[model samples]
Target chain A: MELQKKIEILSAAAKYDVSCSSSGSSRKNKPGGVGNGHLSGICHSWSEDGRCISLLKILLTNDCIYNCAYCVNRSTNDIPRTALTPDEVADLTINFYRRNYIEGLFLSSAVYKTPDYTMELILGVIKKLREEYRFNGYIHVKAIPGADMKLISAAGAYADRMSVNIELPSSQGLRLLAPQKNKESIIKPMGLIRSGIQAKREERKLFRGAGSFVPAGQSTQLIVGATPDHDLNILKLSEGLYHRFNLKRVYYSAYVPVTTGPNLPAIVKPPLLREHRLYQADWLLRFYGFKADELLNDAHSDFDTELDPKSDWALRNLHLFPVEINRVDYSLLLRIPGVGVRSAQKIVAARRIGPLSYDNLKKMGIVLKRARYFITCQGKYYGEKSMNEHIVRYGLISGKPEIQDSTPQWEQISIFPLLPQLPPPEVRLATLTGEL
Target chain B: MIYLYDGSFEGLLTAIFEAYYRKENPEKILRNKALQQTLFEEYIHIPTDEIKADKVYDSIRSKISHQALQHAYYTYLSDFEDAGTWIYRYLQLGWKMGHKVDYHLADDRVLTVHNTSRKVFGESHLLLGLVRFKKLSSDLFYAPIEPAHNIVSLIAPHFSSRLADQNWIIHDVKRNMAALYNKVEWVITELDANPNLTVDEEEQAYQGLWKQYFESIAIRSRVNPDLQKRHMPRRYWKYLTEKQML
Candidate 1:
């Protein structure tokens, strides 16, 4: 088949695996080489689905031996099948790197013939790119499940990062949707890659010339909203992966239903917002020092669609509100609804000069609308209403209209001894305080 | 008094140097091309002096911090209308407060300089990926970009190290300059708006496959053009090979 047609088919099959980051690897170009890794990866473009196109994400082939119900390339599905030769893959990667169209290659494949055979094809393409073409850019390849350990290790020597998709959160979901695939097959390779990365690190510490193995580490993807798995379960599983396997990232793909089966859930659209919320919660877990159980529990298995995970946590833990901005610890400042990591850091830095006022916080680009409800500046409250949970929640939900013009609509004249009585004071007070 | 100088980074630094030694506070510091003379104001044309510029540069590095010097340089590259005046004001404060001037986030002068520097650095970082090179008929890879900031010189070192074996030219079409890399070194020189160039026969085939891959990789169910535009803005679409269809 023609190269364009083959790429269209294979890239479409590979789009479901959404681990697009090309970061954490810092390889320099050889004297006569063609490419180098950007320490913090650069995104080349954004696809129409709003995902960053960091790498040339494509599969070696779409010919699958296992029929996963949620996948587009299931064995029962009628689709054109083709594979790229190692020569073609290398040629494409070199030309694309020269054109500056991608950071590197993200090579994945279906179980063509067998796991070991598919992995060998992948290893061949990467080996050709790294050794023959002298490509030093990022290469994120998949560690084919149930593939031979030696073959996986050999592939790791050439790949900067590797992944084995968990696919479903639970083993029951795996058995129900993908009968041939098991959870053990997925986790075994993750364990192998983790040890491989660890062993390489120890070796490099002793010998400066020791070659790196998977310097960017490993990542995995879980198909969200496919099986009847709760967000809590997914978060717990991800926490375990991060702690046990030392994974670099856990990507949550909002299960885009491509194939219908008895096991898969009938969904019209991908759960994008849910996936976004999971990412927000994931960020809190990774950087904000929040635990999975802290964000979700058995009582609340799903996130509040109306608010973000951080804001939801703040509203539930309202006894901690109105924390003194001048005296609060840095960790407590991070727990505030609107204070992100950058804003929290800025607050800590700016406060070292002097005690900050609300105006100073505003100048530092903190989102005052949500933060004002939970913070006090210099022993003075600037929130619109009192610290009642219902009132605060209502204020958060129905954001206050920004006062663009500083001029008051109603003139306050000193000549009049009484208060300005042109409007209904009770109704205005009720609306502002969320009490009638 | 208004201080006017040739529109170069060195000229801006020379103006700062002259202001310090002369003990006269200028009302506005501007580039020669951006001057708008008022009826009552006295204008002083400060010639570009490399020696004075280097002195101020070294003082900024030694007295203040290397990071502060970078901020000053990046702020100059921003080419904002008030970038010169803001840099002057920022340095005036930096001289008094040392490196702590950058931490004064509430101060408008420091904030403006920091924000402008961030913008300049951000654009250069983005161009590291957005630059699309086409293999010429002569085997020289050429790319044309019209960036919002003067960033051709900033992004050249990156490509020089990455594509060390290949000769390439990154043309800043808006600024009418190019970074010419000859596999060993790179130099920024003036180039015409349009250069006579031809792509190789196989370049179109590779671009066609790239465009196909770009389209195929987007999930049809979750296509959000607004988010795509937010990340890769519409202004940058003209140079992007995959965005040509849109």
Candidate 2:
């Protein structure tokens, strides 16, 4: 087949994977090499689906042996199959890199012939790209499930990052949809890559710049909404992956139905919002000092779609809030609804000069709309005295107060006295009291 | 008093030098083309002086840090109104507080300079990803970009380091300057090359493959043009090969 036709089929086959970041590795170009990798990755473009096009994300072939129901390239699906030679793949990467079209290559393949065979072909491309072409750019390749450990290790030395798609959150779901694949096949490679990265770090410590193994580290993707696994299950698995495998990122792909089967859910569209909420929760776990259990429990198995995970958590744990901005610890400041990592750091640095007021907090880049409810500037509070759960949730989700009929008569009567630029009486009332 | 200088980074530094020597903070610092002279207003044309500029640059480098100088330079790249005056305000603070002024985010002038510099840096970062090259008949790759800030220099180092094996030119059409990289080193030159250069025959095939892959990869059920435009704005769409079809 022609190269254009092949790329069309293969890239389409690979799009659902959605791990597009080409970051975390800092490999400088050799004297003879073509490209280099930056610590903070470069995104080449945003695809029509709003996902990043960081790398030349394509599969080696789309000829599958396993029929994963959620996947586009199922063995039973009637789709055209094509494969790219290792030479063709390497040439494409170099050409694309030279043209400044991509950061690097993200190569995956179906279980073509066998797991070991597919992995070898992928390894061949990376080996040729690194050794022959002298390509030093970031390369993220998939460690084929059930592939030989030695092949994965060889692939790891050449590629900057590796991944093994969990596909489904639960093992039972994997068995129901993809009988040829099992949990052990997926996990064993992750463990191997983890150990290899750990071992490489140790080696580098003793001998500086001893060739880094998977320096960008490994990441995995889970197909959400495919199986009946709860959000808690996914978060728990992600938390485990982060701690156990030392994964850089755990991608949640909203399950887009490509093949219909008995086991798959009859859905019209992918659960994108659900996937978005999961990412927000994942950020909390990674950066905001949040535990998985703290965000979700048996009663609330999923995140609130209306409000963000951080805001939801804040509304539930209101006692922790109304923390004094001037006196509160940096760790506690992060718990406020609108205070992100950057803003939290800014608040810490700015407060060093003097005690901060509500005006100062706004200038420091805090999102006052949401944060006002959670924090007090010096001795003054600008939030409502009656912090009812429903009212707070309603206020936060709506993000604005109703000036029409439903607003309280007492609040309405007071609004006539205030100027247009000034906030409502509720805001002024908190300012007047100097505490809520 | 208003001072007008040639629109070069060194000229801006020279203006700063003159402002300091005279002990006068000009109400406005305008580029030569941007000057608006009135009957009563004092307008002085500041010539570009490398020695004087370097002296001011050295003090900034010594008293503050190179990072602070970079912030001022990057802010100058932005097309924000009164960005020159803002840089002067920021430098006044920087000279007093030294390197610690960067951490003083509460100060409005410090924050404005920081934010504008951040925006310029952000655009340069985006251009690193958004730049698209088409192979010419001579095997030299050519890319045309129109960025909000004069960020061609900021993003040029990235492409030069990555595409060291290939000869390429990134033309900032808005500024009428190009960064030409010739396999070993790069130089910023006046853009004399034609905008409508022909693509190589082989390049057409790869462009076709890229466009095809671009379309095929988007999930049909989850198409959101607004989000795509948000990340890759409409301003940049004309140069993007994949975006051309839509």
Candidate 3:
């Protein structure tokens, strides 16, 4: 096959994975190095399709031995499959980097023969770039499940960020659809990477002057709607990983069905809106001083589809707000609807110099349209003074989805299962009517 | 009053000092300096008076915190329309308040000056991300930008430390000036205009590969032009290689 044709295939196969930022690594340029990771400011390259394009995102190979039902590269799917030599990937990366096309590489793969073989190809590609090409750019390597730890560690030495996706949230989902893979095969590598990243970080701190390392840290992806895991479960799992493993990011990709398999949930629709809401909830947890349980508790294990996580949380706890603008701390202000990170910071900064009023907040960049409903200016509420959570929720999600679409088939799947237990269908069935 | 001088920052400070020294109100001062362009335009040929500029700087330094003066200076260096005089006016207002000015956005002049400082910082941030480097023959590096606000003063230190080893030139074509770095010294130069450098064959090939990679990474399942435009505005599209209208 022509090299360009091969590139097209591999690149297409890699698009499902996302790179949310351009702050590729914390790695700085050394004596003779050519590239350095950007500090402070993150520059992300996004495609017209709204996906991040920082990584020279591609797969090592799409040819797989196992038949994972949800994957397009499943064994039964007669799709054209090919693998690239490590040199080819290195060449593309260096060439692209020189052109200022991308900041780094995000390389993933399906098991071509075995997980180890696939990982070896990926490791070889990165090694070639670091050694033969002398390319000191960011490399986000995907650790294949069941790959040997020794090999995974070798891959780590060359990569700036590594991810071993917990492909399906529940292990039982993995058993039925992806029979060849199990929970341990995925989770073990993640645990190893967390330890490895921590060890390297500690080593660098002691060294004081280590120039290059995985400065950007590690991240993983969760395919929403594929398994019936509730939003609470997802957020709780994310919280556990964040606190325990110290992950950099967790990407939530709405599942897109590309193959037909009996074991896979027959999802003919994609839940794009729900995926967007989940991301919003994830943002609240990460930046808004919100815990996963705070957003999703026993009363609500699933997110309210009608309202955003913050608004829902606010409505549930109405007693906290109508906060006096000049006095509210930055975190409390951030929890208010429509206030962004930038706005929150601006409020804190501006208030330090003066007693801020409602008018002043507008001038400082508060989105009063959303926030007015939740907040007050010196105890004067512009929003409806009603205290009901349902009223607030109905007022919000009642509006159309922001990035609206007749969501594609893949986005709307859902489920739950313990390691070997399938996800319950009732959780995601309100909109789906028990597709199971 | 034609506030002309050696064209140094100190000279500008001297000009501002003269504007107040001659007891001329700002409007009257400008009208007195009007010249060949219009009959109403006056001319006050201010000389290179170092003493006058020093006294003005000394007064500003003593009255406010050094950080405030530095922001005023950065605002002055921004060279935006009426930016220097506004900073001059605002600082005077700040000094007049004695202590109340520190805790008030009550003054419109204060708000305007603060806005200018933030505007310059904002541009510098965009350029921090937007500046693209092209390696030239003999390892000379170059980048071109047409920023909405003058942010060169703010971002020069970042470029110096980030690209510490390379001798590079960043040309802000819109403003008709450039910052060039030698082995250790960074200096600014004014040009009548720039020679729009042509893309070399190697760069073109690299761009082709970049475009491919950029196009490939986006998943078609969620193609939202509105969202893409929100993150990256259409105004910046012409300069970005991937977002160029195909």
Candidate 4:
């Protein structure tokens, strides 16, 4: 087949797998290389739905023997399947990278005849991209389920990152939905990748590069709301995976229910917002120092759609909040509803100068609307008298600040506050206080 | 005391010398003594006095590097800061370095001015996308941007006849700054405030479509209001078509 036709089939097949972030890796351009990696996020383009569409993100081939029900490219689906030669794939990546259109490549494939056969093809592409083409750019490869361990190791050395999609949260779900896949095929390879990363880190104690195997580590995706798995169960699985494998990311795809078979539930629409809520929880776990059990339990199977996960956590654990901002620990400060990493850092920087009041928090860009109830800035309360769950939930949903803006200032709602003219210290206090 | 001079770079250069000599603050400068109707205060026209200006420039060069003096001059020319003449104080620190430590311009004061320089640099970048140029009948180009800062001078090089041989004008509606380029040379001006612009009507439609596409593509699943606020601030929304004017 012509290379263009092959590219179309493979790339279209790979579009469903949406875990394309080139941020974590910090590889620079070396001599005799075509591209560079950026710590600052860069994606070549975006899909119509504002999804990242950069990095010639394509399956090396869609020809698979596995019949996973959730996947469109499952074997029984009888979709048009094709595989690309390593030469064909490398040429396309080089061309795309040169045009400044794509920073790298994200290559995956369905099991083509055998898991070993598919992984070998993937490794060949990376080998050529590095050895022959001399391309020093970011490349993320999939660790196919049941793939041979040696081939997995070979692919890791050449790629900037490697990912193995845990795909199903539960072993029971995997069996019912994807019969061809099993627990051992997936988890064993993840263990292999984890050990490989650890070994590289240990070796780097003395030897410098020695090929940093998967500098971005491994990331997995979980399909939410597909089977009978609860949010707590899924989050538990994610927590275990993070601890077990040291995963850089765990992407939650709102399962697009595409089947009506007797075994499958009749899913009308995907739980997109649920996926978003999970992502919010995931951010809390990684950045905000939150544990999975803290946010969800057996009684609450779903995350609160009305409020974000962090806000929901704050409402439930009311005792923890109103923590003195001046005296609170870093980890506790991170749990405040509106305080993000940047705000936390700014608070640390600002407090070195003076004891911050409730007014000073907003100037540091804290979400005073939500955080005011949670943080005690030098013994001042900007929140309401009633901290009732329903009242707070209602406030979150209705877009009203729990504390009313009693002191109305012009710059608070102005189109352009004079940037050059510094607001008076009192106005700065009002800007800092969420109430005004 | 008030120090008014012929609005030249050197005239302001000399005024910086007198402001320090008199120890007058910015509030005193803006509240001109004669204009203030206060009997004890006085105003002075420093004039296009090359001797004083050259003396001030020479002393600055002797103390600070040429780069620091240039930055101070640009900051003075910008007229953004409350005290445009306070740059001389910074220049005094810069002159002691002369060359070596002048590049260590990342300190608090140097950073304050450098950061403002970046803000002006960013305004130029944003106006690149916001300024819609239209091809006029005589094969000239014209674009108008309503920027909050006087940033036309920074973006002049970007369009300088990339359509060369074609006359063009970039009118800044907010600060009333315009860059009139006639194929080769460019001149900056502050014309009378004219909100009535003559932008090509078709360019408006393309802009509408461009904005529509930008808005349509943002996924509702991840509509992070907090993140959005942290980025595109509410203040700059007036100039950007992506925002809805409430």
lDDT of candidate 1 over B149-196, digit per residue (tens) = 999999999999999999999999998999999999999999999888
Report the error of model 1 at residue A377, Å. Answer: 1.4
Better of 1 and 4 by TM-score: 1
- The CA lDDT at A71 in model 3 is 80
lDDT score of residue A123 within candidate 3: 83
Pairs that clash in candidate 4: A322-A374, A359-A432, B63-B95, B64-B94, B64-B95, B161-B164
Please give the DockQ score of every candidate, comma-separated.
0.72, 0.60, 0.31, 0.04
Q: Return the top candidate by TM-score.
A: 1
Ranked by TM-score, the better of candidates 2 and 3 is 2
Q: How far off is residue B35 in model 1, in Å?
A: 3.0
Runs in model 2 deviating more than 4 A are A402-436, B193-196
Model 2 compared with the native: what TM-score?
0.93
What is candidate 3's CAPRI-style docking category based on DockQ? acceptable
The candidate scoring highest on DockQ is 1
Ranking by DockQ: 1, 2, 3, 4
Per-residue accuracy of model 2 over A83-201 as CA lDDT, tens digit each: 99989999998888777788999999999989999999999999999999999999999999999999999999999999999978998998898888899999999999999999999
TM for every model, in the order presented, reads 0.94, 0.93, 0.81, 0.66
**How are the candidates ranked when ordered by lDDT, highest leading?**
1, 2, 3, 4
The full ranking of all candidates by TM-score, starting with the best, is 1, 2, 3, 4
Cα RMSD to the true fold for all candidates: 9.8, 11.2, 11.2, 15.7
Model 4 chain A worst lDDT window (10 residues): A40-49
Q: Which stretches of candidate 1 lie over 4 Å from their true place?
A: A401-436
Docking class of 2: medium
